[model samples]
Target chain A: MIEVSEAGLLRRRSVVPALLAERGDMLVVAGLGAPAWDVTAAGDHDLTFPLWGAMGGAAVIGLGMAIARPDRRVLVLTGDGEMLMGVGSLATIAVQAPPNLSIVVLDNERYGETGGQRTHTGMGVDLVGMAIAAGIPQTMRINLPGEVEALRQAIHTSTGPLFAVVKIDPESLPLALPPRDGAVLSARFRGALLGPAAHLE
Target chain B: MAGKDWPAALFALLQAHRVRQVAVVPDAGHAALIRLVEASNEMRLVPLTTEEEGIALLGGAWLGGQRGVLLMQSSGVGNCINMLSLAASCRIPLPMLITMRGEFGEFNPWQVPMGQATPTVLEAMGCAVRRADAPEDVAPVADAMLGLAYNTFRATACLIGQRVLGAKTFGIAPQ
Candidate 1:
């Protein structure tokens, strides 16, 4: 069970699973560290390509997936620190506006990997506002436990290049790491997506 | 001569290879080819805010069964150092077409340091680096880079020299 305060923070462990519930054929790109663990904890599918590195690249990778596979939904799960590094990508994504793409920032407001240091979001930087300013058609600032369902629904059914910032409780949890080998991860993902074509070229 | 129409020739080569995505951080040297890619119905031109985004985007494109190429200026190479690790580590087939700056033509002082460091940096990151000093060399170098990248699943870069792109000139303001 998770509790939401007036300060508006939800547990990452709960919110991630809620959002990924019944994730039918969605291709997911998870950022390095906690987001990667978060997605793996939800369930490690061949469809989920969890990054061990490339800290700022999660959202753009999702953009490429959305563009390449218009028939499939693409979701990027990342943290506030990672998202800030690649903030410039929002402008590029806004212009492309791939309807199948959705980027969710789990704003724990701290870099959980680097000894839980305070990130810009902890100091009151607004990721949702940045996304809105970048012209993403749908932007969500999800703060309460009750609001998780709406986000899950929106992810399942929405006309979007949507951006959502979930204010997550900055509590470090035990590791749930996916396979660390990038080549293996890549081959599995490509094979799952492209089938025989992946083996060819 | 191949030199006179290498941009078009290069675009045709990319098309022949079925490069569905063209990722670029717009550079004046790539203007002619960018126009061709933009006008093509076969490819989608993705304008990136920085060179690193192209690296990640193209990596994802490959994951989704589409081939992509990145075009950037030499100075932008410095921005891609950390991100290039993704391509190298993942063994993603990344073919980068880079235009040289800060070398040759005696131009801006700021661009020189990065321009000089470009090849060494890329090589250090485990990317195969190639050079094209003449217009005729551009297509061949790019073709080889594409082959090396796709066939071997390696990160490769073809640095088109400043002479091939023609030196950028400085002058008085145009009214």
Candidate 2:
């Protein structure tokens, strides 16, 4: 029941690091705009996708990975604004009930990547409540830096489908990350997934 | 890919087309396919909270260099009215493979209003619509719709008709 509106940008920036430090290579992060920055900062290492512009695509990709490699963990990094754009997938995922899926929504209450043009998530649309309504097995709502470790623990020992709403500031961007497009990173991810050592890679 | 197996047909069709990522909102008609895709390592199934979220996911999936599809019930189509506007405005090529809910032989009252409005909404949003009246027809119809959506940069629909014979969910919990 944590409303994201309660937090500032810098305070929320810690979610990315918290996830990566906790999950390591066990997760795949995807989405648009600032959340990508979150993904890169968390990886400290780097990430790639073959994308640009398509907003809410990460959750599905994460869902796919969750189902394909049930042994491995998958996390979708998303924006409240981007997610509001692609809501139907929720109902679909709920019914499919993939146990490995964890949809982590970085609710900043605005399309920080889209010049702050307002979003439905900002106007009292409870995203955590919505995920629960959509049938996510577990839902976590937190808007403070202090809650990151607990979230990390939940993700590590998680028996999902878990929906986490980490209230972050819309302006948080990772430092020292280079720019990469969906195509460049996606090629690498594809190589990573399809390569000979896919199990070991 | 049998007559009573729309889900099989969907799986084979998507597999053949090399569709790497697929998205959907849960619906009785689409549940089986979602489960099958969820099991496939080669394909990515994204279960979304809304039809528009699937659209957005497809946009990002495509941006991430992956081919994508979206599935939803006819009633959910009504919820996507504004999102269709977002797709059109963003010029994102999102082709949706949706199940029809309120047409002939329909039973769900919840589907009637939006089911009736499904094609109209797509048309109004400048997306092209196609319907499938038989289970066997879904394969090629879906292929053509995806092709049209990708190549032409226009959203295409493969609407599932009630007459298309298949395993009906009837709101039953999947076994």
Candidate 3:
């Protein structure tokens, strides 16, 4: 396993909050493990559906949301390991080509949740290249803090099945869990989106 | 009812139940249904590379306040076992239309294990399995499964028998 140094990598705690700051009613789906905590730390809102499990399901869930609510921007934040597990989903998302959806992979180059073991990304796997190959219209690799604003704009306003791999530090941080109960999270999210009619459905 | 009519009937039943999304992995058994979904402008047809992705896709669609269905072969059931836990545990409604294989004149030996195991596996995963052995039974079984899934948020499976699909010949080209 190739060792990833934490020296110059972006802090997930800092990047997630910044990206989500201008989120105006955008629905968010956070993948399992660190990405879920990252979104919760950013701010736990009813609009954010954070997965307690379902390791590789985040992006496709975002795809479903994007398809259901075309007017609302849907953003998926997931770890590199999780993204790699369901990487084939990018092709499906691209084929459907929902302009409202964007996927951001927090590529820390390791599986941080299961102990900092180096993942395929650390061994030179190219996630952005894979996204491009998968036919996503827009793809990027963000290594600098300054590039995040552009990604934020693209996510909020671009015509895309967009994908980005944001390089982050491998350093462990405090756990910030959202509601663990899947039923509660699902109901709360649906209620927030559909109002009183949520129960009727 | 002819075998060709069952796919359209099933599609109509799904529409009546307000299933706006159809997530599928390509298979000969589900080809007609897939084509029907793809041709429809009213429903979103999501073609998945693997059957497991269909499980997540449908779950996500449900969470987003849309009803969806998964169409796959019996062999694909193995691929969906672990992912089905998400729907089962969360009580997310999953309505699956599975086509049976490896029974009643199946030529492929590899398909037997998973095909024979499909119903038991789905049952273990908390899905109520209903079988349709004849062309006429497809729509009613599908209707009941959809009702069970959408009205009560239960995981349900409608398994179409291989006899309904007709036995696949080893060498002869299909007419």
The 10 consecutive residues of candidate 2 chain A with the worst lDDT sum are A1-10
* TM values, all candidates: 0.97, 0.59, 0.95
* TM-score: the better of candidates 1 and 2: 1
DockQ of 2: 0.15
Instruction: Pick out the ten consecutive residues of candidate 1 chain A with the lowest summed lDDT.
Output: A1-10
For residues A22-103, could you state the per-residue lDDT of candidate 3 as single tens digits? 7999999999999999999988999999998877788998988888899899999999999989889988998999999999
Question: Candidate 3: which stretches are off by over 4 Å?
Answer: A1-6, B1-4, B172-175
User: Candidate 3: DockQ?
Assistant: 0.69
Compose the digit string of candidate 1's lDDT tens values, residues B59-174: 88999888999999999999999999899878899999999998977368898999999999999999999999988899999999999999999999999999888777678332
Q: Which structure is stronger by DockQ: 2 or 3?
A: 3
- Docking level of model 3: medium
What TM-score against the true chain A does chain A of each candidate get? 0.95, 0.83, 0.96
Cα lDDT of candidate 3 equals 0.88
Alpha carbon deviation, residue B13, candidate 3 (Å): 0.5
For this target, which candidate reaches the highest DockQ against the unseen true structure? 1
Candidate 1 backbone clash number: 0
Q: Rank the candidates by TM-score, best first.
A: 1, 3, 2
lDDT of 2 by residue, B1-175 (tens): 5566768887887887678877777777787889999899988766566666666556545434456788888777786665565356444467888888777766656667887888998898798999988877777788788778766655789898866734345776535
Instruction: Point out where model 2 deviates above 4 Å.
Output: A1-10, A43-51, A117-123, A170-179, A196-201, B1-175
On residues B1-175, what C-alpha lDDT tens digit does candidate 3 reach at each position? 4355998898788778888999888778788888888888889889998888887888778777898999989999998888887787667889999999988678878989998999999998888999999988999999999899988887899999999998777887645
- Best by lDDT, which number? 1
